[model samples]
Target: MNSSLLLSLAITGGLVLAAIVAYNTWTLRRNEPKKAQPPDPSAPSAPSAFGAAGMDPLLDPILRQEPSLDGDLAGSAGASPLEGLDRGQDPHDHAIDPSDALRMPAPAHMAERRPGLDPLIDVIATLTMEGVVSGDAALAAFPPTRRAGSKPFAIEGLNDATLTWETPAPGQRYRSFQAGVQLANRMGALNEIEFSEFVMKTQAFADAINAAPDFPDMLQEVARARELDQFAGDHDAQLLFVLRARQAAWSPGYLLQNAARVGFVAGSMPGRLVLPASTPGMPPVLTLGYDTQAALADDPEQSAIRDISLSLDVPQVHRSEQAFARLRDVGAALAQAMDGVLCDQNGQPLPAMAMDPIAADLELLYDQLDARDLSAGSVLARRLFS
Candidate 1:
């Protein structure tokens, strides 16, 4: 061949080889699993579910970069950076001056003013009294067991002084009374038998107080209970993420040590730890649990723990807390620290793709709950879900 023709052939071969290499690289990339990027600690969090209500943003938990397990674990694994910072005077230890106490206005009324009976979730019974009754009298007339079968039974009084409904308490006078039985709970919808039992309890209380008891139509209430129960069952979400050890099984102490670095504290129960809610007295944001047997063993350090679970009870936590987001962040952090992988209850690896759909679904569920005036983390939603 001529030199020019040979050169032309070599150029064509080179072009074809370059095209093949590019195609292979594209194929490899396309087939590789997509990794989820860890959330940027400095970035503003997603808008809260309660943002529409203009709730205080300060209520949200402070965000910090999750520490890597590769660091010195023994030095300060779980300690907060703000630990040494001055927090002003301790409220408990500070003595209140008598003049300051006198200057403080008395509360307008007792804080427990809201009535116990929520018609939306309870089957209510109105009790009309001929005259005012003492709270002591009402309390005496209360049912022996504060339950109608599996449902909670409660009685509230219209305070003669405050004109607000409240649970009957001594030294107060009530112009009228109301009783309620929960319509449904996790146990199931209220049935005719439970309704009958509720009526019996309310009627007896009314007789003892010499009041006229008016109960709702049993059939209609039962139907409403079933519908409410169905909605709750469909919307309820209790998410759980399992973390499996990648290689060597972790001891209970090892798991606790790593989990603590991510803000987990010992729970009330054995083999359990919790990420407490930002608000005091609210249910915990997340629960971390492992083998109870391992926790209870005399030598817990020797116990081999292959897997642990992180759980979030949706309705119990306010959406403003960004609990689900925290669950993901904490799970990722712990997985990195403990050399573990996040999985589902069935031990299947949980990928970012799988979780994205869940987040979307949760938003929809929150909307549905809000539409029904049972927004997640509200008193009504908590009661209904329970």
Candidate 2:
């Protein structure tokens, strides 16, 4: 009996100890943070990648609230004369302040140059002007083409990959959509020519701030961008031109007569476009530069997902080389400053400025531009240059 009692006691003790350990483990687990659950696939809605809708950067003075289209985008609603006119000033509503034009938008005005006109002119002029100065008559050989705006310029098979949305892990999948833009690194080298030109114009041995040592050299670039826009028939001309201007742009302050302007892009010129305030890590033109398209494939749930097909023309800078990686993303310094946001979403990304907009209203505006016929000298052109 004594032996049996001792055995039973031992067995009971062992069971009790195991029960304590098991209970403690259960308690600890119950108090621990629950594993992060995946987002329910059937949720009614999710916040936008930008976290909101109906956002606007600059409101029209009159309309007060509408999609803020870049003024120069042909059919932008509530847009001003310069809607799409950042790099180039609309000579129409914007009378080139005779003083501004005469003085030149060199380094002195650099500090004051906000988003419009100066950088655009500076970069494009930089890119094309040198050829003109060196007497590359081929650029001037452009036959007079009628008024054309916002046409698709063939990229000669840039072959940006098509993108599709991933149903699983949509957040990570969406992040990968940047591949198309990343692939556009091929254009970076093309911009080096522009920067070289910027350095020449700003640093050239011109005696005066505004003087273009090569007279028509600067103007030739504008003509080319315009011609490219007219003939090529896509936003690529404008976009590439902007990229070149922003990235390649440099001011020598080379040998200005004004001591203050000596190291400046000439006292007459403005310094540079300040990057807009960081809104969720986007620069202003990032939104402008990116075009959002629908995911190539539809979700069975029709999860209302879209892919943003963004092609960035980057020059080498920082580790940004890892992203686009063609050459140093040329104007990465400038791009570093731009902040972008998705202020709103259409059911589809078609007609998204830069992408396509699916919204009926936005689409109509896009259609108007698509159907728009610029008869060589359109109203906007005639009013300005004429």
Candidate 3:
């Protein structure tokens, strides 16, 4: 062996080793999951997941904090443009203020009544008092439990001064009272046994208030409950879309980071996030949930999550928000960002085509709800569905 041959072979071996290391590094980098960028305050807001068409401004990540409706209305409605004008000045000289234009009050039929038990969803028993009674007395006479079986039991007093029916409050006086039990809910329809219990509870309260109780026919009320329950069962729609990891499993932090990019905030429960509704105080438009155990683990960053679910409770959301469309977009956005596939509960891949039928059916359900006067997102609908 010559010295030249030995030197050439050693150099070649080194070059081959260097090539292998470079290739390995490239492969690892390419295969690694993508990282989400920290949100930038100065950057222009990203468009909707699919496109700008029909995008809700409420869902924009940059503008997630919506202005309060009351604040907007108060600033505009509280002031009259004609203010500060000199009393002696001619009113005709100034430009007509748009805000000063004549405003019409909502028609009686157009205005929704304050939240309370309704005959359409409750079995009411009227309690006619001989004279006005103290609210404190009525409160003391109330039933111990607020529920009869699965249905809610509530009592409202007719306020002597306000001329409105409301729950009895201290320091108020009532002319009459009414007790009601919800007719149906997710649990089931109110049965004969529950109706009897409601009557007994009402009668007891009436005796204490020195009122005459008038109960409805038991069979008729029970029958009404069944019909309502059947309608609810037929119309209720809870849609779920599962996102399954394609290659790399996600850590809770990684999953959360991507979810936050799409406007989901941490929910009250572990492993849950919610896309809030545009209307404050209403239920979330959508919910994103993953493995609770992973979220609870000591090192959530180390826990692997293979799948997460996005759900929408149809009747709970207003039709105007276009929640289903938002759900579809969010699901797609998450799936793409996480390198996952959207699937059904059974793990079947959910194609775009599969969603169209669901949307069509949803329209029909909304029409049915509107026709029945249990319009989706109304207080009554939320109560009945719950």
Candidate 4:
């Protein structure tokens, strides 16, 4: 054989062997089943911050941040810096979560649960004397005359106190206390004068009964009261509209249900409806009901109905227009519901045109108060009014 022919044959044989090996490897891989890759042990697992309900609404915003781009947060730090901090914190810690701050503690007075008294007693001045007296006595037995707007007062016996005692059977024997008065509670200054008169009148009663009486210096209290009253009158002067049942009387149950529909809750007094107070012990901005009696009786099932009145504490609200408008609307609804007529202090019926002037006046008054930096129904207003 020639040398070149032999070399070509050897090369051809080598190429055939290589092709056979490649074919065999392909067939083996095709026949075998594919196996899944095991999870990487090096990757960290994410901790779930919520239950089956999924992410909390408050946390959704924070979690929505995308960390993919440039390996940086999408925005500034979100949520509280101490979102996942342990709740058992030190008492002196300054860092309070916003959500936790929302939950306010109850007031000291409410925690003590002081017994409630007749709201009339709170609003009115009261004078009491313990001795043998009659419950059925007339107002003539008292000094101050009963009038309207300017000077109004009431006289009743201490029969209510006798009933307060735990021991029974002592109807009028040992509990022979007499003479209680409900003086007007409009303002501190006016009440000062009313209270002084009350003190003097009680002195006369003591003289008549040959009894010694304890009295304080009237001049100082009166002066202080006058100052307080002046501050209140300048800031807390209120405008109100009265609604009375025109033909038939309004039931207490009906009144409460209707008032509640308009967002008026049970007030401090029986016959009163009030919006939420600005702060604890502060008077509500809006109040409604009758003057002489409570809005509702202690026992609604066995109580008689009387005339209903609605009033608004103007200074107690930030927006006088909104407050006045809401009151007017609510009053109109109540009047219509109870088959009553809206009126002024007198029996004269109120027209729709009447509210316009009142609204304007409220705006002016609100501006005045705001200018003086003593917004009505604010902490300052409440302090002065108080």
Rank the models by TM-score, top first.
3, 1, 4, 2
Tens digits of per-residue lDDT for model 1, 1-386: 69999999999999999999999998866433222234466866443322322222222224321212111001111111101101122211122111111122222211221337798899999999889999998898888999999899999999999999899999999999999999987677899999999999999999999999998899999999999887776665566678888876777767765665566666656777777676666677777878889889997766778888777767666777787788888888878877789987667888877777666656665666666777777777777766
Tell me the lDDT of model 1 at 111.
Answer: 20
Better model by TM-score: candidate 1 vs candidate 4: 1
Predictions in order: lDDT = 0.69, 0.23, 0.72, 0.44
The candidate that wins on TM-score is 3
Question: Candidate 3: RMSD over Cα atoms?
Answer: 16.0
TM-score of 3: 0.76
Put down candidate 4 lDDT per residue, 302-352, tens digits, no spaces: 333545555554544556336676667777877876667876644567888
TM-scores for every candidate against the unseen true structure: 0.71, 0.19, 0.76, 0.39
- Deviation from native of the Cα of residue 79 in model 4, angstroms: 55
Q: Which candidate is the best by lDDT?
A: 3
Clashes of 3: 0
Those runs of model 1 whose alpha carbons end farther than 4 Å from true positions after fitting are 1-115
Candidate 1 lDDT score relative to the true structure: 0.69
Question: What value of lDDT does candidate 4 attain over all alpha carbons?
Answer: 0.44
User: On residues 28-123, what C-alpha lDDT tens digit does candidate 3 reach at each position?
Assistant: 665554443555768775654434322233335354433221110000111121111111122222222222221233222222335998998999
